[model samples]
Target chain A: MTYINSFRTGLKEGLPICMGYFSVSFAFGIFAVESGLTVWQTVLISLFNLTSAGQLAGVPIIASGGSFVELALSQLVINSRYSLMSVALGQKLSREVTLPEKLFIAYGNTDEIFAVSVSNEGEIGTRYMAGLILLPVLGWTGGTLAGAVAGNILPAIVASALGIAIYGMFIAIVVPIAKKEKATALCVATAILFSLAFKYVPFLSFVPSGFTIIISAVIASVIFAIAAPIKTDEEEQSNG
Target chain B: MDNGKFFIYLLVMAGVTYLVRMIPLTLIKEKIKNRFVLSFLHYIPYTVLSAMTVPACFYATGSTLSAIVGFVIAIVASFFERTLIQVAALSCAGVLVTELIMNYV
Candidate 1:
């Protein structure tokens, strides 16, 4: 396919992902404001971060005057998966994507975009990656702007209801995968158990919230990786 | 938050996030062949999200009962393979309706 055709195909594939991001980021906007961030601040976070969970996790740290170390550490732990994704996607890039182009593409290497790009039939070019990243960036930032503005105007009850929106999105992402894969289901269950222990158990409760997330996720993932090593071929087949 | 401090925070976040992505994409030319590592990476997102969701999501709304209602609604919607927006909108609606009912009672 020509570059334009590749780009157009990417745009087509990205439409649904863009639409999905809008609603989820809208909730992020509302939640951020409720947590004390101004509308512009919330919007800026989405613009720069382009990550749902990382932004959600970072807002609390920012609002509560948590240290920079805490904020940076939280983002690193929460978003570390992007490193793995970028490495995977990088392997599929066409030679046309030089270092500068890779830098540009890296900005949009989000979970859904990476998934869409990697699932393509052959080598992915720079134009296709650009087209794929564009709409979702717009949707994510635009949704945050709209939701942040609406957040200031919306009633308390409505805002409160919207609080669960991100978590709802999180559940949506995990449930289907968990249902299809036994290891994933057990992993999720184990992580939840760890999370609850952090919240309720006496000594663990003293652990900072960011570390709680890091520790719980890491411990659960390590255990499951050992107990149920996935067949690499099976993993690719499922992803594709 | 002071303007300067907030910007610093944003910079740090965007910086670390960008580097994590950029370094690997720009430099890595080979696929990682470690079985344990691949499986671990596969499980990370699910585990991180699940860890963040529980207990925290249960208290998301004003009332735990309403939050539970929303959580269950989201689970059901997604179980049927609903799209992300549909699941999110439904969960929000679920919480709103439950809370409104709670007020009446």
Candidate 2:
């Protein structure tokens, strides 16, 4: 596809993500504020971070009066998945994708953007990713701004219900991919079981939420790689 | 949280997040030649998203019952290849209605 066409398609394909983010980040706004962050601080967090889980995870630590060490470590563990996503996206990126572009685009490389970019039919370029990331960034940050301003105004029932929307987006990413590949199905199951084990096991219970995510993801991916290495040629067809 | 400490918190969170995304994209210049390593990278997307989800989704909302109800709706809707918005809207509605009913109970 031409750059402009790919760029437009990227934006069009991203509409659902934008809408979903608005609702989800709206909840984040409320959470941040209810947790005692001023509206500007909440919006500032969204503006710079653009993360759902990391922000959700961190704001509470601050509200509960946790230390900087706890917050930083939590961030490193919860968001370490982005490093894996970055490597995966780096593979699909056009050679013309430059240092400056990579630097800017890297900030927008959340789960949804990575999913949308890799699944595209043509060479993934900067313009396309920029288009893809733009609206969601707006939706994510804008939603937070709205929520920060009027978060407490919403009825408790409504505000809490909106909380589930982001998790819904997470499910949307996994299901379609898993349906197409048994290896992926196995990987997801392993992740779920591992996450549950960490959550429920008494001794392992102290493993914080961030570390639990890192460990589950790394183990599942590593095991899948060793057990079922796709031939390089077969990779193209299987991935699509 | 004071403004200064809040900024420090935001700085760490934003900085580490950016570093994670930047390091692999900027540092990894060539195709990973190792097959095992290549496979690992290939599977990371699916695994990481899945791992992050699970237990988290089931606890996304206040009411565990309503959250499970929403979680199940999401999985089923997405399984049928429903669009993301459709799935999210459906699940969110599911949570809202479930919570509404439970509130009355």
Candidate 3:
């Protein structure tokens, strides 16, 4: 019953997320196919990677015959947030959770899952977190496979247009929180400044997008922290 | 696509990705004490999203002029705290219109 209820909750939260993933992953599938990867290889990548930016970045690297070290470093930089997310969720989880369970749940950590997990309050057990993780993974992987199979059925223009959905989803997540929190607003502004600098500044222009995101995130976080510290009560609650 | 090499790569990628996520939680069992670190993690999402959206406003199309015009329109719309969907849609529309005009003129 506990697992069932958790699954149901996950499904409810994951449905809209799945809808968004369908369009983005569909595009990824087409891109992978066009990039000389077979359908099975594409499916495997989606099943394991489950990160749009990481996979998109890595695909080009692989195609260019980049070394494994480069691929790993790029993924590390882009998906480093999962480490932070795992720590945040670790606080919410029951202390008695086995190491194996933690290992299993960690596999499914992505931006969307992390967002939902962090936003959930109170005592979050391993089972519930697992449900949250599994449902989204399933949805994303399923979408990728379906898209790979349905390749080229949709017009190129339509696919390109729909590619914006993932960006829209990110905006949806950020804008609401930024409106409510001044710190969020400041962080966003700092990130934009740094991002533009990385892109336009001649010396920094050569930095990869993944590394740029990591650098911008670190810089923004430092600025925000100095400007506004979290209140004691909020800290206590988060720690608890 | 050789099935054997493909599956090997998939397994290696999965293993590496999972390990990255596991290391912090397994090693840093205690609460995060460094104020700077906490602050950094807290603001990462904001920075990432802003970085993505800002350039997206410009450079999405081939022309820099259209990007600037589209970005100005988006900034004005966003000042009202418009919904994301509305802001994105409007910005995309702005870009399309600007490009179309630029082409004909």
Query: What Cα-based lDDT does every candidate model obtain?
Result: 0.83, 0.86, 0.68
Off by over 4 Å in 1: A1-9, A30-38, A57-71, A84-97, A111-128, A234-240, B1-6
Write candidate 3's Cα lDDT for A1-240 as tens digits: 011226567667666666667666877887887777788788889888888777877777665556677777777877776776677666555666678877776777777666666566555566666667665676677767777788779655445444554565566666666778887887788888898899889999999877777788677777787888655436786898
| Worst 10-residue lDDT window, candidate 3 chain A | A1-10
The CA root-mean-square deviation of candidate 3, after full C-alpha superposition on the true structure, stands at 4.4
Candidate 2 structure quality by residue, lDDT tens digits, A1-240: 433336787799788999999999999998889889999999989989888989988898878878888888888888988988898888778778899999998999999888878776556888888889989999999999999899878998888789889878888988998899899889889988999999999999899888888899889888988998856645666786
lDDT tens digits, residues A120-165, model 1? Answer: 6657888888888999999999989989888678787887787787
Quickly count the clashes in candidate 2.
0
Q: Would you give me the overall lDDT of model 3?
A: 0.68
lDDT of 3 by residue, B31-101 (tens): 56667666666666567667766665454444777666656655655566665445545655665666677
lDDT at residue A126 of model 3 (Cα atoms): 67
Candidate 1: residue A83 lDDT (0-100): 82
Residue A235 displacement in candidate 1 (angstroms): 12
Q: TM-score for model 3?
A: 0.82
Candidate 1, residue B8: Cα displacement in angstroms equals: 3.6
Once model 2 is optimally superposed onto the true structure by TM-score, how far is the C-alpha of residue A27 displaced, in angstroms?
0.4
Best by DockQ: 2
